[model samples]
Target: MKEIAQSENIEQFSLKNYIYIDKTEYIYNLIKKYDRVFFSRPRRFGKSLTINTIGTLFEKGVEPYFKGTWIYDKWTQNTCPVLHLSFLKFSVSDLDNFKRDFCNEILKFAKTNNITDFTDDKEPKVLIGNIFSAMPEDMHIVLLIDEYDCQLTANINNKELYEKFRLFIREFYAVLKGEKHIRFMALTGVTRLKDVSIFSVGSDIKDLSYDHAYSQMIGFTREEIKKFYIDYLKLGISYEKHIKTDCVTDNDIEEFLDRMAEHYDSYCFDEIYENKVFSTYSVNCFLQSISQNQRVIFGDYWYEAGGIPSILKNYMESHEIEIDKFQTSEISINYDDFMNPTSLPYMNENVLMCQTGYLTLKSEIKPPRRIKLGSANREVKAALNSLLSQKFFNPDALDSFYDADSILEKGSVEEIIEHLNKVLATIPYDKYPVENESILRALLLMYLSGLRCDVRSEQHNFKGSSDLLVNFKTRRVIIELKFSKDGKDTDTLLKAAQEQIRRREYGIEKLGDRELLQIAAVFDGSPNMRKITEFKQIG
Candidate 1:
């Protein structure tokens, strides 16, 4: 064993330097049952490391790395002729180049086994069979492929080009089927390319993506945190002394853990067991921040390093969905709906969000079959909030929204509308088409929620629902929104809006003694143009 340092950087991610979380034993045991396996997980969730671990365990002359781990003692000398490849290492400009590079990679593996009968003129898809033929009859080949769908994800927006790449890759992967010479084959990637028709051939290939047994494979469980991170806990003292300039205590350490979990944990994949797991990338990033700054710093490091996927941004805007609604709505998608891919501009936003790691599975329903989803954690929420604020709300609108806190504090509905109209006026003309009153409502709802205000849209009350319900510590605001076509009287629309709120008695049941501010707003325009007709303090 190497001399252990009093404080080691958890961000040092090599297996030799990294603290082994013991998932390798579980993974090795579970994976041995299947000859061909496919596992998909979000990026930076430790897919590469897991692939590396598996390769190390199976390949010859790599026993030194596993010296301290469970796989070291429990297993016999079980080595195989391993052929490892990662798509990250290859970038091709055209189909011919891709084919050439692919064949060369496979041929390189064959040469290592001291078999060199394959020619450069051979097709890449059939190259695997040639490699299989060249190997000794007694030996079986172990094939490990990492980031199998990297090219497709990298060019997701270019559907025309991506389709070509997908077709070629799918055909190549299809070659793995019925290959008796293969001892084990595993492919790992961030996404499952369901449309590609790659894994359709084999019932033997296990998709451990959502399996409960492997949920803890790619990331940290709470138990793993306590077991592996005990030494780094004391780094809080160094943080307090050097950075925070405050006293550090055991309570602070506990608080740090809680905050860490809140920001980066709570990603659930399995339907039967909704196990919360931390994103290994974010955890390492957090630990690295603490080590470098000698203090705890909360950030969207994952988002910072890897921004929101462009596909997600395009989906929200094209659907004309309110950014706030996209953030908060109770989205449910059937299993088929979640897995199947439609064309761009028509893709299911909920599925895209869930698969991309922004949203985590919340619950599963059977018989009609649906999955409920919400933001994975505070990090995701923060990233979305920042994206929404940037894409939709301008500084003037944001200022007006913040001013609403004080406007509501004074129980003045008219003043609140004045602030809101300021926000409305500042909205960029190209923000959204604002085709109808619904879009207008969505704007306000999204903005208010983004500000971290307790705002609900279409919240049901005793008699009916309020368009917007703003909650405060000791008060509540009930708002009714109305829209009119051009030439409609602004005063009449405002009166009708007020009448609806009064008729519903939105706050009668719950606003005892606490301030109840009733508001009404009216707007007029076609989808192309809109202006506020009236805003008033109804009560």
Candidate 2:
């Protein structure tokens, strides 16, 4: 940012560069109400920077860093021996080395602060409180910890490590929980993780994750979006029309805001409220994209890219339940079900993903709540789709990639459909029974979707949508598959299929002979797809 590069601190006005926007005001406001604060946000959502700014304001040093920010005017320059410790580095593999490693780090930190009270064989928690105790009588102590879940979350599968690390951390945090030499305290992480457990001393500090009051404290709000658009017009984004109508313009706006919304947005704390959350990662990426002319979004590098999906794929493939219809109820309606760090590991990924801005909570039944992967942000969706369909996937593969022209021009539709049918026929009815036709359609979509083309089930039509439709440029085909399960008679199934097709307007477009079309019938009258029925297009 020009503000960062230029020495003219007085001229620096807006925070269009880093994650230093709303969290500053948030910390300042919280400092007024609560002496001790524990805030949970997904990683990289400006927690560290916020804490850093707090140190600059209240700590002993105030040089170039505290120049033009709003805190300068309001800050009384309180002389406090401030201690900044990051929880992310507490990561250890095993229990024995873990304790020694953490203790050594704390010792080194104490030496840096001119504190000599710590000695071997002493509880680390007691030493942590001494950080404040050693401060001069003239100065108070401000403690800031970022990524508070690191010690407990990292290498969570190792029970021995977790128990030891948990106890150590519980003791370390207990010093603060007990309010020992603690003033203007703040702790940051992705989730309010301690509802089931505790760290030692204090009564529960306020958790604002689901609180409606400070919802906009961490990310850019819709109003803030308009302000940014207005200020940065050279980006060529128009928010005027949206302002008149009390809406944000989706068209012609640089995909930056949209991308920001997708990666971090759609985090609705309350089930009834429809507010979207902007992730700290995607917003920063957008700013960098604008600065360097590189378009990026949540999918490009927000968090773990191909890894999580592949992990989920492997688990679903190995399991008996059909992956397509897999729901949270299958996992006892627990969002943290994905938190397992083994086959499909959840600890690092879950906490880190949420903190780094990839996944968010969709809803909560009671304790943990339901976590979903993708954002409901339209801009973020567009940004990701552009990257995933074209950026991530290779363009050279024809039957391999989405450029369907190569497939329609060079290959036979009949052969393709027949090959797909052969594969479909192989799926044993006993292995994956048709719980419902919709579920069957979803399974078919999953299999067909893997083939590069934009394969969609329940394709939108005049009356409704088709069961499946694949549009490859000029070559378009609509196919309707039917399955009769259990006690349902063939006539009833056939009628339902016909009505669905008619309602969905499957053949309304009228494809020529150059295009191959099939109205395939998959009869699951018995346990196998032995009885077959076929329908072909005359055109």
TM-score of each: 0.74, 0.67
Worst 10 residues of 1 by lDDT: 1-10
The numbered model that scores best in TM-score is 1
Model 2: lowest-lDDT 10 consecutive positions: 3-12
Give candidate 1's error at residue 364 in angstroms. Answer: 2.8
Residue-by-residue lDDT tens digits, candidate 1, 468-527: 888787788877888876637778988888889888887666666777777788877644
Candidate 2 global TM-score? 0.67
TM-score of 1: 0.74
The sequence of per-residue lDDT tens digits that candidate 2 reaches over residues 1-539 is 23111111212223344223434456567677777666666544556666666666666444544454555556554566566777666545655555555667667766766776544444556656565566565545677777666655453455565567656666666566656456777777654444224421345566555555566666556556545433332242323233432233445344545545544467554323455556545554555454454322224334332223322233233333433422111212344443322211233333333333333445442446554443334333333233222312234433443423354334564645454444445445555554665656654454444333445566665677667776664566666767666534666655566666656557566455445353544455455443334333323
